[model samples]
Target: MKIIVDAMGGDKAPEEVVKGALNASNNPEIEIILVGDEKKIRPYLKDSDKNIEIVNAQEVITYDEQPVNAIRKKKDSSIVKGLKMLKDKKAQAMVSAGSTGALMAGGLLILGRLEGIDRPAIATLCPTAKGPILMLDIGANSEVKPKNLVQFAVMGSIYSKEILNKYNPTVGLLNIGTEEEKGNSVVKTAYSELKQISSVNFKGNIEARNIFDGDFDVVVCDGFTGNIFLKTVEGFGMYIFHQLKNEIKKSPRYLAGAALLKPAIEKIRSSMDYSEYGGAMFLGIDGVLVKCHGSSDSKAIENGINVAYNSVISSINEKLREGLKSVTEKGE
Candidate 1:
């Protein structure tokens, strides 16, 4: 399958993006299409590989630019072009480390949403206390309606079951307290609806602080809250890791323990990096769309490629079409 990669997005720009895409393309089973300025990309790529191609793009949207506005104005930007290619079926999926808003807008505006799907939500695999956790709406819809939350739950459930290998995964609503009446109006409404859905394994509300403690398999919330929650966890993980290292460096006994636990610490730290989990899947789209981390290295890019390939070959979109229709028919 052909997977399109926007080579202009992220902090490292063309170099890291190019290397990541090239490394992904190394897998003979898949073809990688890099969308960016060909003149720049060509020089970085010494020669040609059958699996890789550079599509010329004139402009690139920066993080500071308004996502939807930049997407509309920069018609030749790498993200928009790659999105168009997905719509045209020139690629199975589109991967970008660009403006999150622009990518979401382009996916809906260009590729369109699936049938029976309202707003699309972003779901990323996260490392949690138990194992991998699926967090929906990391940064898709900031403001959400009750119905939107229901849809997010539906989409997130399908993802957890199909892609994450979770059977009847416990779905949790991110809130301040574990009780049903704990959160604001949004959570109060969503909790009632989610609990009513018998098909889903609703496990009640999950507080933000215990999210990494693994209270549930899939956590659902609006992008606004989910984004804040994600960032806080990342920050906390980094702070604690650095603090532990600083302490260990000052004492011999602590340093000895640190040496002994280096492997275990690396494993834990790597698990929380978010990149190790690959990209965030844009649910409710007509096709799979993954938002790779801006600082994604070769391994993360490779995981994104594998996800794209599996998404296409598995006929995931087609299955979602059927699954969603089934749920609606059942009045879920």
Candidate 2:
């Protein structure tokens, strides 16, 4: 399988991206296509294996640039070229640590949405006590209708079973309260529709407080709420860890104790670290797209490449199409 990597997207850009892609190239079955300025990408690739391929892309889309405008104007940007490779079937999947808006824009405009899909939703895997739970529309479409929510649940379920290896994953609507009538009209309507779909294992509602408890496998929410929820969780996790380290360092007594507890602390940090999981999967799109964090390191890029490779081999899009069609037929 051939996977395209955007070597010019994230904060670290070509350096980390090249290192990660080269590391991932160790897999004999997978080939890496690094898309960026050839001059910068080639130097770092001296130690890379023969599995790596470089594609030259001169322009780059920055975070501050308007997403739609950047995509339209920057035809030779790494993001656009990598996405085009996937669209043209030259590559099976695409991974990027660039601007989320530009990636989403390119996915919709270049690759297009799946035939039955109304809109593509961003599905991010969050580490939880039970395991990683899949949440959708993390930053895709902020405003959506009842139908969109129902579709998100459908796509989320397929993703959990196929990619996460969860069988019959329970789906829940993220809401203010667990009651059926608690949310706005859109969510209330989505709840009723979700319950009717036999393919979806719809569990009425999931409150923000209980999400970490591992009660639900798939959580569905509007992009606006889900983005805020995801960011808050990430920020709070970082804050708590930082504060703990600072407090432990203040006293020599606590510092010595922390050394003894180092193993346990490392385990907790690993569980909460987003880097381990690589990137978020953009579901409902025609091709496989993994959006890594803007500050992703080499390890994260390697993980992202693995996800893209596996998703392609697993025929994830086929399963998604079948799952969506099954739900639509039964619901109709």
Candidate 3:
């Protein structure tokens, strides 16, 4: 399988991105095509093996640039070129740590959506007490209908089972309370519809607090709520770590205790690290589009490429097609 990597999309640019592509290319069966300025990317290729190649992309889509406008004007941009490779079947998937807006816009405009999908949702695997729980619409469609949530549930379920290797993953609708009538009209209507889908294990409403408690395997919500929820967890987690370090520096006794607890602390931090989980998949898209964090390091980019490879090997899109059809037929 061939995967395209946006070598100039992240904060570290070609260095970190190229390192990641080289690391992922250790698998003989996988060929990685790096998309960026050839001059910068070539130097990094010296240590890489035969599985690596480069495609020149002169322009880049920055975070400040308007997504649609950048995509339209910058025809030779790394994001646009990488996505085109996937669309043209030159690559099975595309991975980028660039601007999320540009990636989403280019995905819709260039790659299009799946056959029966109304909208594509961003699905991220978040750490939970039980394990990694897949959440959808993390920042895709700010406004959505009950039908959209229903589709997200279906897509998330198939992804959980096929990629995450979860069996009969329990699906939940994120809401203010666990009650059926707890949320707004969109979620309320979605709850009613989710319960009727036989293909999905639709659990009742899931509150924000219980997200990491691991009770639900898949949680569905509007992009607005989901994006806020994801960012808040990330920020709070970072804040806690910072506060702990400060507390440990207060005295040698606290420092001693911190050293004793170092392993446990590192384990927790690793679980919460965004890089460990790789990239979020733009589910329901015609071609695979994985979005890494903007500040992703080499390890994160490698993990992202691994995810893209797994999705292709597992035939994730085909499974989604079948799963969506099954759920749609059941709902009808």
The best candidate by lDDT is: 3
Q: How well does each candidate superpose onto the true structure, as a TM-score? A: 0.95, 0.97, 0.97
Segments of candidate 3 deviating more than 4 angstroms: none
RMSD of each: 1.6, 1.1, 1.2
Q: Give the range of the ten consecutive residues with the poorest summed lDDT in model 1.
A: 41-50
Clashes of each: 0, 0, 0
For each candidate in the order shown, give its overall lDDT on alpha carbons.
0.84, 0.91, 0.92
RMSD of 3: 1.2
User: Roughly what TM-score does model 3 have, to 2 decimal places?
Assistant: 0.97
lDDT over C-alpha atoms for residue 63 of model 1: 84
Using lDDT as the measure, name the better of candidate 1 and candidate 2. 2
Model 2: how far is 251 from its true place, Å?
1.7
Q: List the residue pairs that clash in candidate 2.
A: none
Query: Model 3, residue 284: what's the lDDT?
Result: 90
* Candidate 2 Cα RMSD after full superposition onto the native fold (Å): 1.1
State model 2's lDDT.
Answer: 0.91
Give the Cα error of residue 74 in candidate 2, in Å.
0.8
lDDT of 2 by residue, 167-275 (tens): 9999999999999999899999999988888888998999988989888999999999999998998899899989999999899999999999999999988887778
